[model samples]
Target: MKNNLTKLVKKANAGDKQSLELVILEINDLIYNLSLKMLLFPEDAKDATQEILIKVITHLSTFHYQSQFTTWVYRIATNYLITYKGKKSKEFAMPFKEYAVLIDSGQSDTVSYAKNAGELALLEEEVKVSCTQGLLLCLNSSDRLVYILAEILEFSSKEGAAILTITPDNFRKKLSRSRQKIRNFLTNKCGLVNSENPCRCHKKIDFLTHQKVINPNNLRFAQFTKRSIDLVDQIGDLEKAIAIYRATPAIPAPETIMKTIKETILIT
Candidate 1:
């Protein structure tokens, strides 16, 4: 797949319009998913994904095949996300202490917006994904990026370091610190990580819905997910706290993103 992407990139760099479109098609989901995880909002993710795609396309000639095409793409994507100061980034720029207080403050009132079991299940899933993604925001952008690459995306330390232009040992240290921070919070506050914890996804659904933090009519995370992360075979051995992120469904890029990219390319 990397080889094929490299070939497409080469063709696109040589002015093959079809290959350029194909290149966008191949990496759209990847860029969108990473952006969504980093930004924690679909609209913000969409906006950031478009910008990053434009960067990749505009800088196509700079890729000299010294690294894997995907790695190069990741380097570009990660750098953009780390420095991105989007609306949600500012809103969610909080320490773990503040976030933990927010989590603990939720009411346990039972409010059912769902008419049936399936709808109720979806709402619960929405809370789980939203809550976990929110936890990620507690980490600063740099640590958040490290945790996302090392845990959610499962990149090796060396690979992550290379993408971030850091040494492997430095990458590992950041990942360890970030991982422990999240684990500590989840272990104390999240029921999924510890059965003794008071916070449950189902219990928070009512509070979150009433607070307008999550809408059953328009779920941001659960609506796009086809399968839970636990259903995937590769995550069985991962620690539960770390695995919670993997549970986020692989959200695809917006359907019109390709058309928009093509038009933008033509204009530029």
Candidate 2:
């Protein structure tokens, strides 16, 4: 499956727009899902997917096959996100009214809270929707970019190093610091156990994934945080934390994208 997918990707990279679109469509759900995980808004996820499609089309020929095509695309999306790091507060929220219908075709059937019989009445189920939101709140644009690339994208230490344009050793150090920052925020402010309790950290990662979370046993989060949650609480007020996201003081969207394509992508 991975190899055939790679063949399709290579074709797409060679300028097969239809194949490219198929590849994009093939991964669209996870792309949307990942965007939502990082951007934390439904509309933003949709918008990001749309923009990412344009980028993938424009930049396809540049795909060097150095990494798996998905990883390469992930790098592009993350970098575009970093460069476009606008305020997060304005991102479109998912609508509760149409929540069930907005389901992505590739969504994971993961559950977070266990169920057997009547369970909600007595079971002390933990909800960390806001904790995920709050963690994004604490991280700066660069920090969030690195953290998302590492955790949500499931990039290996070496892979993340390549994407971030840093050495693997350096990437590990930065990752450690990012983890520490999250732990500190939780412990100092909310008084949660930093590293002693493994489940809490796991729950935090799961919330960030933003997938179907009804069944407790099915929720599979990024496992990097399984051992620790000692993030440093250096984060301050929410006002400063948010750092208003702006869309690069926009001009017309299509024209800009076209210009970017012409300038960045070299075609035969």
Candidate 3:
């Protein structure tokens, strides 16, 4: 796949319009998923994905094949995300200490509005995804990116450092710190990580639904085709907290966004 992308990159750099579209098609989902993880809101992620794709297209010629093409794309995406001052970024700008307090304040035993077992399951999945994504926002951008790349995305320390332009040791240290931060929070607060915790996803379904934070008709993260448990089964043994993130399904980029990207690329 990498070899094919490399060939496409060469063709793209040579002004082949179809190759350019293919390259965008190939990486759009990845970029969107990364953006969703980074930004924590699907609309914000979609916008960021488009912006990142434009950057990738505009700078395609500058990629001299010195590293993995995906690495280059990650460098671009991470750089933008690190500096992005999107609404969610500002809204979620708080330390884990504060975030924990907020989590503790929510009522866990609120009545759920789900009509049946299936509806309740969907609601639970929505809350789980929403809550985990919120946890990522507690970390500073640099640490968040490190955790996403190393823990969730399973990038090696060397690869992560290369993408972030930091030393591998630094990358490892940051990932360790970020991992511990999240693990500590989840261990104490999230029921999925530790059954003793009172914060069950099903418990919060009522509040989230009542508040319209998660609409049953339109889920942001839950894929109807595959449940979260399916993802969990695929993830091998790992820290339960980290496994939750690793188990997150890659969000597919909206086809409308893809269309916009292709049009933008053709115009450029």
lDDT of 3 by residue, 1-268 (tens): 9999999999999989999999999999999989988888888888999999999999999999999899999999999999896786577667888878766765666555777878777778888888888889888899999999998898999999999999999999999899889989999998888889888888877677776667888988776325684465456777688878877768789998888986676765
Point out the higher-scoring one by TM-score: 2 or 3.
Answer: 3
| Tens digit per residue, CA lDDT, model 1, 143-237 | 89999999989999999999999999999999999999999999999888888988877788888888787998998878776446334335768
TM-scores for every predicted model: 0.95, 0.55, 0.94
Tell me the whole-model lDDT of each prediction, alpha carbons only. 0.85, 0.49, 0.85
Estimate candidate 1's alpha-carbon lDDT, on a 0 to 1 scale.
0.85
Per-residue accuracy of model 2 over 118-220 as CA lDDT, tens digit each: 2321121212332344345345556666666675455778988887677888888877777667544444433233334333323332343354332344322
Q: Tell me which of candidates 1 and 2 scores higher on TM-score.
A: 1
Task: Judge candidate 1 at residue 261 and give its lDDT.
Answer: 85
Report how far residue 70 has shifted in candidate 2, in Å. 1.4
Runs in model 2 deviating more than 4 A are 13-17, 86-127, 189-268
**Comparing 2 and 3 on lDDT, the stronger one:** 3
Stretches of model 1 off by over 4 angstroms after superposition: 227-234
Clashes of each: 0, 14, 0
